[model samples]
Target: MNLPKIVLALGYSGLIPFFIGPVWLGFSPETAPAWLDRAWLSWAALIGAFMAGTFWGFALPAVQGPAGLLGIFISVALVALTGIAVTLEFAHALAGLALVFMLLLLADFWRERTLDTIGGYFRLRSTLTAGVLIAITWRYLMLPAGGA
Candidate 1:
């Protein structure tokens, strides 16, 4: 189905690095460079923060109620966790990022039941999140110290 072009564009735009970073790393040195690792981790943390903020923005327009309050808290926690996660080891950070995205997708899916998002919003979110998770997990395994 045709989803909102803006959402699709923004979503995929955010996803490109997560998708491409892994692919780029795969073709690079067997032992990935320190700079590349730092760069990808930085990008992942930034994107995670941005996604959490987007959810917070959605809560702003929502009616003052339990759902809106919950959304706000979820969004905030997502950022908080991301901040903490980024400071951890690279392997830990990837796993944390994967969890963060899963929680984000779940939060959006749950929020959509009560609040109004663009049509097919959940589908778009799920697809992008799944793609991100896959890329991260794949890269995680590829990391020398990460699980294989």
Candidate 2:
């Protein structure tokens, strides 16, 4: 498939675990099965890595290679680090880091599109990412800690 299609697929796939992670494990932090928690976290990290790699692949050509890859790596690192922090019971710090990353992602999207004069592809990707984050927070975090 083409670059944009691949980016979109990666973006959508990365969203899956964000939705599932909190719902399956975050909500039931105390009761969730160890295996299930491990499975969900692993899925989330793998999908996140795939998304980051694909994003860099699409961006590299536009950003002159190394810079694009570096940006993607940093973004992935932030996500993974914050995820670990969250899992370690640093909710406030994780929330703060997530906010920073979200803002950075938005800024990067804007800069890339403006500098490259690209189409609406970045906008669509950003929208999808934001939607997924919102769904994760609202659907999962808003629920009681261990409820159906």
The alpha-carbon deviation from the true structure for residue 40 of candidate 1, after best TM-score superposition, in angstroms, is: 0.9
Model 2 bad stretches (over 4 Å): 1-10, 22-32, 47-87, 90-97, 100-104, 114-118, 139-148
The sequence of per-residue lDDT tens digits that candidate 2 reaches over residues 1-148 is 1357776787667677666656656466677675654464355445444444554555556565656656666556656654563354334433544454475466456446533435665665577657655744554454455432
Model 1 alpha-carbon drift over 4 Å, by segment:
1-3, 30-33, 145-148
Candidate 1 lDDT by residue in tens digits, 10-120? 888887777666777778665666587778888888887888887777787773987778778888999998898888888888888888888888888887886657678
TM-score of each: 0.86, 0.51
Candidate 2 collision pairs: none
For residue 30, what is the lDDT in candidate 2?
A: 75
Reference-based lDDT, each prediction: 0.81, 0.54
Backbone collision tally, model 2: 0
**Which candidate has the highest lDDT of all?**
1
